[model samples]
Target: MGEHVRAGNLDIWTEQVGRGPEVLLVGGLGDTVESWQFQLDGLADRYRLIAFDNRGAGRTPMPDGPVSVEVMADDAAALLGVLGLAPVHVAGFSGGSIISQELALRHPGLVRSLVLQSTWPVMDPYLRSWARFVRRLVEFAPSERAFLEDFFLDIYTARAHNDGTVDQFIEEVLAFPHKQAPRDTQRFLDAFIDHDTTDRLPGITAPTLVLAGGLDPTARPELCRSVADRIPGARFEILEGEAHQPFQEIPETWNSRVDAFWRELAPVT
Candidate 1:
């Protein structure tokens, strides 16, 4: 329910809750730690949960000018260090997944396990093109409606939209502290634009879980499955009737799967 220590040169605004094996959550750009709101409360009793705003986003102050994803990953590790917890379980969504990958790559000893959702090792050709297409909405269609429509069209399965809960979603997004900061937006997008870490997927040391929405054009199940195939002992789960934001789009299914993922690896201590 409060903030954690500053990591390196960054303040690293974060929310830490619960009291078991530490789990750190990272979110996409323009997404605050609060994006995890719906998932945290239920998991709090069993896990020591920490969610934070990445550098250049939300309350985490950017380092003057532009920053790279590598730096962002470092910030995440530093946050963990400050909490006196080493070897954490990590879960990242969208750009957050890239940050987790970078952390696992640079500091393999610090990660006990990994969960990647709605994200690929890097942007595939189609996703790269799609990102470029959506980037246009920043200017041409600045309104939330336009972006929401594009997001729904590009990411969600038809079944996800069947019940009509978008208004609730709109309010949640609006309530977040990260309401459309262009600098953070551009920096975040640029990091994924030409990056391709598929070659390095095999280097990850943690037991991995790759979660992808079946209908998400950006992080298709096939791409995430490919990521899982590369990592030793990694598992892939392709959820039907979901969107890019599956944790929020369908939390019960997400909560159940995530709870199981952790329980399966519950330490023998």
Candidate 2:
């Protein structure tokens, strides 16, 4: 269901599914097209969904020199242009949201609308400190499992933890091949930490929706709201009792909410 597509300078690994209006899903740091399995399955009936592995993640190879959000945004632009899927709806999660912001700014013609989930406009002191700790943990963790266990703490809600969802995630990740190397993970984190789009939000011409989890520790509702406030006519919504990854924990609800937003813009026939 996936193929290697020549986009930009890399042979980007991409997956496409379903039919109808095109929708592109962008994942966070260290994520791949597999990260949106739930969406690919749940939303495909109504959307022509596309997902891809970012540079240095999964099947995509890292290019020489450094990577930045702008570079990654350009990559997305190239992918869409190459596929002739321009003016498509774009949804970005966490670090992907940052890249999406840059994409909307740098290549506005490629984007029809934007959905930013678990997004932040700037890396504040709190997030900076947490990112620093994460870098240290990545550098020092004894094993991959150990690192993921600690990393999932900030990503999922208490309910997910209590209901064994986090465990399931760990099991799947451990079983999946093409694990992101530590160096690549650090490189992605470095790009995420250095990104800032505070003054540039107003430049994005795409209609935008910003969603945040009420219980998310990393991209808190308050911070996410600030992003919504900055963008003209962007809607902000909070999924109560959810954490950073509601799309995985509650795919049906997440998909329905997103579907409704898109429908409001262009009614489904």
Q: Quick one: best lDDT, which candidate?
A: 2
Off by over 4 Å in 2: none
Question: What is the Cα root-mean-square deviation between model 1 and the actual structure?
Answer: 2.0
Q: What are the per-residue Cα lDDT tens digits for candidate 1 across 1-269?
A: 66746788878889988888889998986778778987788788778899998877787776776577777888888988888888989999988898898899988988989999976767778988888876666557667766776666765556656666665666667666556576567777887788777889899989999998877777888778888888999989888767688898788889789878888888422
lDDT of residue 53 for candidate 2? 96
Whole-model Cα lDDT of every candidate shown, in order: 0.80, 0.92
Worst 10 residues of 2 by lDDT: 127-136
- Tens digit per residue, CA lDDT, model 2, 25-96: 999989999889999999888999999999999999999997899889999999998999989999999999
lDDT of 1: 0.80
Worst 10 residues of 1 by lDDT: 154-163
Candidate 2: the clashing residue pairs are none
